[model samples]
Target: MRVVSLVPSLTEAVALTRPEVLVGATDWCTHPAGLDVARVGGSKYPDLARVLALRPDLVLLNEEENRRADADALLAAGVPVRVTFPRTVPEALTELADLAGALGATAEPDWLVAARRAWAALPEPGALRRAVVPVWRRPWVVLGSRTFAGDVLRRLGVANLYAEDAERYPRPDLAELRARRPELVVLPDEPYRFTADDGPESFPGVPCALVSGRHLTWYGPSLAEAPALLAAQLAQPG
Candidate 1:
């Protein structure tokens, strides 16, 4: 089955699981190294014409990463679209398992099995560290309630300060962010590249953990190593 993936995580999952089935993917699908599929632009603003030209039997998207208008347009053009929205690690595994079933896999993919096992092995946290997770700067958008990233942090014993906010991605001013008094600032290197010099300076007294966005945010094969990898980064002295 020919597939076009607009979500990077789903693209990696599909590409790694069944590479030949993916005929097109967004430019942001940067995993598995040297993926040579047709680029359909970015996730939020994919080139619909290019996507249509691919003539894929199926198209993969995420409720958060993709626009509804794009999915509608694809459906309007008689293209089948599979949109996934996984808010927690278990949900992510379920989503991948569902996708695996769609790909005609009689058994769970090895990566999926490994991911399940890896996450299951994460030891319960002794104490939680309150943190502010900024996904973007300028306007300062942060991880809020009901986000996959927020849940990922929760699993790692880092509670998001804005997780109770109404918006999934809340745009709060810098002063307000600092006022929250997060014990740590968890910075991921995607959506915005928060380097050691870039993000840590903002939270003067607080420890800052520079992490891989793919491991922290993406819900694919990377899930297998996320627990240990993120733990090590979070363990750093900032």
Candidate 2:
């Protein structure tokens, strides 16, 4: 079954599990390093004609990473499209299982098994640290209420300061974020790559943790390593 994947993480998940099924993927799908598939385009603005030209049996999309119009167009053109919206660790695991099943592939990949175990083995929740996690820098958009990243941090004993905000991803006033007085400021490298030299300086008094965006954001094989990787980064003194 030929597949076209718009979500980078999902592309990696499918490619790692069944490489032959993936005939096309977004340019952002950079995992499995020498992936020799047709590059459709970016996740948000894929080349519809290029994807249709691939004549894939299935097209994978993420609710957050892709646009609805693209999915609609694919469906209208009679290309089967599967859209996944995993908001938490369990949901992500379930999504992978469903995706694998759809592709006639086994969901019991070693990395997937390890990821489930890693998340399950997370230490019992302890004292929570209030943190403001910024995904972008210019105009400063942060992880807000009901987001996958927020849930990931919550599992690690960090409470997102904007978890109850009206918007899932909100661009909050820097002064407002500072006023919240977060115990920690977590920074990720994707969407808008935040770095030690760039992000830390914004929060002068708060402890900042530089984290791998793939671990914090991507919901694939990386899940197995994220728990320990994030814990170590969060443990470091900012």
Residue 234 shift from truth in candidate 2, angstroms = 1.0
For model 2, residues 1-238, the per-residue Cα lDDT tens digits are: 9999999898889888888889999988888789999999999999999999999999999898889999999999999999998889899999887777788875477778899999999987799999999998679899999899999999999999999999999998899989999999999888788887888998998899989899999998889899999999888847
TM-score of each: 0.97, 0.98
Which stretches in model 1 have alpha-carbon errors above 4 Å? none
lDDT of 1 by residue, 80-154 (tens): 999999999999999999998898777888899999998899888778999999999987999999999889889
Among the numbered candidates, top lDDT falls to 1
> Which residue segments of model 2 deviate by more than 4 Å?
none
RMSD, one per candidate, in order: 1.0, 0.9
Error of 1 at 26 (Å): 0.9
lDDT of 1 at 234: 88
